[model samples]
Target: MMLIDGKKVSTDLKNELKTRVEELKAKAGCVPGLTVIIVGEDPASQVYVRNKAKSCKETGMNSTVIELPAETSQKELLGKIEALNQDPDVHGILVQQPLPSHIEEYAVTMAIDPSKDVDGFHPENVGQMVLGNLDKCFISCTPFGILELLRRYDIETRGKHCVVVGRSNIVGKPMANLMLQKLRETNCTVTVCHSATQNMPELTRQADILIAAIGRANFITREMVKPGAVVIDVGINRIEDPSRKSGFRLAGDVDFDNVAKMTSAITPVPGGVGPMTIAMLLKNTLQSFARSHNL
Candidate 1:
């Protein structure tokens, strides 16, 4: 079985973007600027924000991080978003997820201008994506990254059966839509299974390409996958591993050890979808920058 090396793929994409960013900088006399807002002190969110900032510097882009206290009011956060929205220097704006219980996530999403919403959670961008208007839409990063991986690998999707296990807005939903788009290398019959799905294994066994995004560890077993199928595991869960120094190991939804034996290709947990998400986020930020400058 071939391992889908997301780390290598993401590095290649970032290198390509770095070169383009230099060209844009030389021509426009400015680099792309991205602003990330994080509310509360969620450890995972903090780490993600730090990585994003590092990537911006690597690509010769400008980045800013705004950290608000856990008790910051909704109005206060919205006011900050509005300020960034009007800032010409800031092209992309992202607010990390899982805000404090007191804050309304939907309200925060709507406050950001669609053009600056690099996270692609805004209503306008999501609507545009659903209609297949790629020209104006910024797709959710993880789904966009998955498509890039498939495209780069030259996988055949036309008229094939694509099964997506999970229905979360972030990965599963957008992924299904992207697979169904009538574009080059992406027209497929898409099936989505969620928590309520019955005979789930039956549906999965028919897939030419299987996407596993359910938030559970080792959820997709070998029997559920078709032989020679391409598996994309989008779930990341921490499970106890006493053998490791950290005492926990990261695992994807698919049981990689057993499932890989059944599939022709598959993505591993840590190095699979994680790096791609960041790469796509950087790409979206650059796209937002280009649009801001009318380039």
Candidate 2:
């Protein structure tokens, strides 16, 4: 079985992006800029934001982090988004997810200007994606990362059967749409499954490519995977493990140990889809900059 080394892939992509940014800078007199807004003190979000900021610095892009109190009002947040939207220097705007319950997540996402919606959560960006527009400013990060991984490995998806086991807007839905686009390399016959999907294993076993984004720990076992299938695990669940130094262990939706034996290729937890998400975010940020400048 081939291990899908997302860490190496992400590193390679980042270096490529850095080189591209250098070329763009020499020609355009500026690099891309990404602005991230964090509403609360969620540890995971904080870590992600920090990593993104570091990536921006390494790539010669400008990045800013806007931190707000947990009790920040909805209107206050919207006001901040509006400011970022009007900032010509800011190519991409992203509001970290799982905003405090009192603050409406959709409202904040909608507040972002479509052109600056690097997270691809805005209705306009999502609509453009549905229409298979390559010129769209952004697509959701995780799904975009999955596609990148497949492409970098020269895995042809055209005419293949792909099963996506999730219905989330952030990953599953967009992933299926992307895979089914009428593109030469990505014209897969895609099936999307969710909580209510019947005979889930039976459906999964038929896939030439299976993506698990269900956010459940070790949910997809060897029985669910077809031999020679390419498995992309997008789930990152933190399970308690006192034996570990951090008192927790990261796992994906697929039971990696067992499923890897059954599949021809598979992504491992922690190092799989996780790193690619950030890489894609950087990619989207650069794309947004290019679009904003009509480059």
Candidate 3:
């Protein structure tokens, strides 16, 4: 089985975006800018924001990370979002998830301007995406990244069976919606399985393309995968590994070793969907910039 090298694909996309940003700067006298707001000191959130900021700089885009204390109130955060919404320099705005328990996550998601919602969590954008108005709204990065990988690799999705194993708004839901779009590269019969799914294996084994986003490590085993199917592992779970200095290693939903032997292609964790998500975020930010300036 061949590995779907997302690291390479994402890098190639970034290189293209870097060049576009340069041309945009030359024509519009400004580059696309992304602002990330972090509410707490969650280690994983910090790492994600840092990587996003670093990527923005690498792609020749402007970036700012607003570090807020854990005690920041909902009104205070919403006020900051409103200010960024009106800022012409900021083309994309993203608030890192898992806010303090006292804060309302839904309120924060709705506060951002839909046009600048690069994370694509705003209700307006989500509705537009569900209606297949892709050019008019931002799509969540992970799902967009998955479609990009499939298009780049020339994997056929038309008239195929796509099984998405998850139901979260972030990944699974958007993924199923995108795959079922009546677009050129999309248009698949999608089946979404979650905690309530019955006969999961029987359903999964029928997929031509299987996407695992259930957030469990090594959850999709060989028996659950169909031979020659394309598997996209979106779950990144850290399992304890005594051999590693960090005391853990990253794994995806699919049991890679065993699943790889059965599938025609598979995406590995850490190097797979992770990189693509960042790449798509950059692309979306650039698109937002272009739209704002009529470029």
Candidate 4:
């Protein structure tokens, strides 16, 4: 089975973006800038934000990170977003998730300008994506990265049965919509299975391409996959592993060891969809930059 190496693919895409950044810099006399507002001291979010800034610098883009206390008020956060929205140098604005319990996530989503909504959670961008107007939308990074992986690996999806095993807005819903669109690289017959889905395995076994995004450890077993199917594992869960130095291991929704034997190709946990998410964030920021300058 062919392993879908997200690390290698992400590196290649970043290198290409680096060159594009140089071209844009030479023409525009400035580089694109991304501003990320992070609230609280969530360890995971901190790591992700650091990686994003590093990637931005690698691509010759400017990165700004605003660290806020856990007790920061919602009004203060929204005001910060508004200020960034008016900042011409900040091409993209992203506020990290899981704010303090008092803060409403939806309000934060609505605060960012649609043009600068690199995370693609704004209602305007979502509307454009739902209408198949991808040119005007910044799709959620994970779903966008999955499509890029399929394209880069030359996987055929036209009219093929694709099963998405989740319903989360970040990955599943957008992925299904992307596959349903009449695009050359997508255009798959999609079936989405969630907690409400009946006979899940029976439905999943019929797919030619399977997307596993359920937030569970090894939820998709060998029996659920069709032979020769292409599997994209989007789940990342930490499971107890006494054998490991960290006493835990990262696993995807699919049982990689058993499921890989059934699929023609599959993505491994930690090195699969994870890396591509950051790469696509960089891409979306770059796109915002290009549009700002009408490039």
Candidate 5:
């Protein structure tokens, strides 16, 4: 089975974005800018925010990270978001997730301006997706990256049976929505399986393209995969491993070792979908800049 190299695809996308940023700077006297706000010091959230900031700089764009304390009040955080919303220099605004227990996510998600909501979590952006107005709103990064991978690989999605195993707003739902769109890069028959799905394997075995985003380690086994089907594993679960210096290893939703034997192509855990998410975020930021500047 051939491996779907997400790292390479993301690198290519970043290079293109870098050039675009240069063109914007030369023509408009400014480059795209992204601002990330992290409420708590969750280790994973911190790492994600740091990487986003670094990527912004690498792509020749302006980057800013606002680190708030765990006890920061909701009003305080919302105030910060409003300030970023009005900042002309900031083309994209993202709030790193998993806030402290006292902070309600719904409020924070709604606070960001839809035009600058690069994370695509705002209802306004989601409404555009529901209406199939793909050009008018930002798509959540993971699903967008999956589509890019399929398009780059010349995967014929038209009329294909694409199964998405997850229902989270972040990945599964958007993925299913995108695959079912009447577009050349999408236009596939989609089936979504969730925790309540009965006879899940029976449904999954019928897929031409299978996407795993259940956030569980090795949840999709070989028995659930169809032979010659293309598998895209979007789950990244950390498992303890004594052999590793970090005392743990990362794994995907599918059992890559066994599932790879059944699928014609598949993506690995760490290198597969992770890099693409960041790449797409940069792309969205660039798009926002282009739209704002009429470029």
Candidate 6:
């Protein structure tokens, strides 16, 4: 069995983006700028935003973080988004997700201008993606990253049976759409399964490529996966574990130890899809800048 090393792939992608950004800078006299908004002090959200900012700096792009207090009103947050949208210097806008329970997530997503919505959660961008006009909108980071990994490894999806477990806008829905697109490597027959799906195991077992994005840990076991299939784990769940120093451990939806033995290729939790998500965010930011400037 071969392990899909996402860390290595993300590094290569970042290097390629860095070189391209340098060329754009030399020729166009500008580098991309990404603005991230973080509301409240969620530890996990803070780490994610910090990683995004660090990536932007590494790629020679401008990074801005707008920190808001936990008690900040929704109106205030929307105002901040509006300011960033009008700021010509900001090429991409990403609002860190899972905002405090009181805040409406969809409202914040809609507040971001479509052109600067690098997170690709805006209605306009999502519509463009559903229409297969990627040139007109930024695709969601995680789904785009999945396609990148498949392309880098030369995994052929054409006419293959691809099963994606989850229906969230961020990962599963777009992933299914991308795989079924009329493209050479992505012309797969796609099936999307959610919590309401009956006989879920039977559906998953028929897959030539299985993508698990359900937010539950160890949800996909060896029995659910077909032998010699390629598995991509998109779920990142934190479980309490007293044995660990942090009193918790990170795990994917798949039971990796057993599933790894059955699958021809699999992505490990910490080193897999996680890194690629951030890399793709940087890529989208660069693309947004280029589009805004007509470069």
Which candidate achieves the best lDDT against the true structure? 3
How do the residues 194-266 of candidate 5 rate in per-residue lDDT, one tens digit apiece? 9999999999999999999999999999899889999999999999999999999999999999889878889
- Candidate 2, 1-295: lDDT as tens digits: 8888999999999999999999888878888999999998999999989999998898889999999999999999999989988988999899998899999878898899988888888888888888998676488989888888998888878899999999999998999999999876579999999999999999999999999999999999989989999999999999999999999999999999888987888899989989999899999998888877777
> lDDT by residue for model 6 over 11-82, one digit each (tens)?
999999999999989988889999999989999999999999898898899999999998999999999999
Off by over 4 Å in 6: none
Error of model 4, residue 16, in angstroms: 0.4
lDDT of each: 0.92, 0.90, 0.95, 0.94, 0.93, 0.92
Q: Which regions in candidate 1 have their CA more than 4 angstroms from the true location? A: none
Tens digits of per-residue lDDT, candidate 1, 1-295, equal 8888899999999999999999998888999999999999999899999999999899889999999999999999999999999999999999999899999999999999999988888889989988999889899999999999888888888999999999988888888988999877689999999999999999999999999999989999999999999999999999999999989999999999898987888888889888999899999999998887778
- What value does the lDDT take at residue 199 in candidate 4? 97
By TM-score, how accurate is candidate 1?
0.98
Determine the C-alpha RMSD for candidate 6 after optimal superposition of all C-alphas: 1.0
| Each prediction's TM-score versus the true structure | 0.98, 0.98, 0.99, 0.99, 0.99, 0.98
Q: Which pairs of residues collide in candidate 5?
A: none
Which of 4 and 6 is the better model by TM-score?
Answer: 4
The reply for model 2, stretches above 4 Å from the true place, is none
**Candidate 3 lDDT over residue span 16-116, tens digit each:** 99999999999999899999999989999999999999999999999999999999999999999999999999999999988999999999999999999
Displacement of residue 285 (Cα, Å) in model 6 is 0.3
Off by over 4 Å in 5: none
Clashes of each: 0, 0, 0, 0, 0, 0
